[model samples]
Target: MEDLNEVYLSPLPDSPYVKPFRFNYTQNGKKKTWDLLEIHDSVAIIVFNITRRVMIFVKQFRPAVYYNCISRQDRESNNIDTKKYPASLGVSLEVCAGIIDKNMPVEQIAKEEVLEECGYDVKVTDLQKVLAYRSGVGVEGAVQYMFYCEVTDDMKTEQGGGVDDEIIEVVEKTIPEIEEMLQSQSILPSPPSMVYALMWFIHHKADKFRKTFERTCVECKVK
Candidate 1:
């Protein structure tokens, strides 16, 4: 955490999310210039339901992803309107996440994100940080902090669909199904946070989760 002081004055035309700017400085004696997209730093949370032995996810449609996946011809084609198909083509299964738009600490933001996007009551300390990263280095550099948390049945405080003006579908998947999804990248396009979170769990907590799942299965079998 460094000093928090920056004022963004420039923005891309007709787009609220991205701010385009130019960076000019001397690089090894010669002056260098770079055009960049100023994006906000954010937090991502991988919510695991230890009680039910399932990983919580969210399904949402992203316009940028839809636009990127569409070809030039498709964008121009009149036979099938690209605008009509964005809903189906843009939906992605992803971990609960939100941008750091407030003055609160990153952990607090993560906690709010978990509650708003995943329907879980969680403490800031219960949230474990997975990694911090630069989201898009090619065009711009936006810090992304990833966290992981586990919730129980008692934590079901609300049905999450984000705060306001957001339509997020809460989804839960078993470890096996998640494993299958990890391999199927095309059918269900996943973000880096989602994939890396699963990978981190596998590398660090898979054994414990496996036992938990086995115990849960036994309990289900007994009933």
Candidate 2:
């Protein structure tokens, strides 16, 4: 999936998802203008799979991540060499997430994202509210609603790899493996929301899940 080539830069075109604007204001008798992007609020879900005893994440290529990593000279030249940089640098491991484009509740959007991105059919009530925070504070400053959900093998309706032209891979990591990543100095490229959600899970839900898993294993062994 990391076979990326023929990368180039282009000017920002008109889009419904993003709108750039300049705001002028007077502060202490000085007039100043700041540029910002008007973007839709988003929802992120931290999915824990009880059947597999792992956390579910979605891995996908992010254009902005790729654009920032390549050499400026290569970017300006409109051609990027796959040998030096490699496309893996552009891929990121992120929680199940989506933009709030429809008028439905954020919980419903989060539910759909889990099913579409991770192949988990969970109910809206299955999603527990985590916290809401502002993302892209400088440029966009859009509110991102966060949620947590647990799923089992029964919820797997299909191989959720995203819809339309999106190419996403579902990744699963055990708790110990994730903890090892947390201790590593050079972790993989991931978003702040994913890290925060993992930390929240460790602090709030990890122990309970671990105990339940251990008890279930012992019960099965005894049986």
Candidate 3:
């Protein structure tokens, strides 16, 4: 069980799932060209560990999110080098996520992401769709669907770090810790998708979560 020799290839040319192109459109009766990235729609899952009374997240390095966060002052002062520090550069604490490149329903894709990235084997029917929005509207118009799922320790079937080449790390935090993190000044270091999803969860799912927290289970030892 080992990884094979990696063959690096040109990003756009190597991947057929994503494409970049430009087209002209009339804006206010004036023709304008906008370059866009065409990527499949995606889904993100905000999972709650009901038994543990915590939120389940997956941490992975996202270069795009990381590079965009570097301020002009820091970039100049720190002499930032992408090649020197990549993995330590931008780690995202996000929910399980994946693009809808297959023909399956979005709910099924969300369930699969939960299993692949968070190690939670959940039913597609249990996933609650929260919202759908377009991402990167300025550069691209990829739509993303957000979902929420409540899980327990019994649902974890493996130490999920994502499949194949994906190196993912699962994380859990209690509500208090999550609240503090949300209000802190370190948001520039976190994923917006994760933040938005958490906010949505608090607004819509908090009541159910509170009940689940109070109801103790022997496995979690919440008492």
- Measured by lDDT, the strongest candidate is 2
lDDT of 3 by residue, 91-131 (tens): 77777899998899999889989998899999998898888
Which residue pairs collide in model 3, if any? none
Off by over 4 Å in 1: 1-16, 76-86, 185-188, 211-223
Specify the poorest-scoring 10-residue window by lDDT in model 1.
1-10
Winner of 1 and 3 under TM-score: 1
Residue 128, model 1: lDDT of: 88
Per-candidate clash tally: 0, 0, 0
- lDDT score at residue 141, model 1, on the 0-100 scale: 85
Q: How do the residues 90-196 of candidate 2 rate in per-residue lDDT, one tens digit apiece?
A: 89899899999999999998999999999999999999999999988888899999999999999999899999988999999988777777777764588788888
List, residue by residue over 173-221, the lDDT tens digit for candidate 1.
8877877766775544677667788888777876677754355555456
The global Cα lDDT (0 to 1) of model 3 is 0.78
Model 3 scores a TM of 0.80
Model 1: colliding residue pairs: none
Which should have the higher lDDT, number 2 or number 3? 2
**Candidate 1 structure lDDT:** 0.79
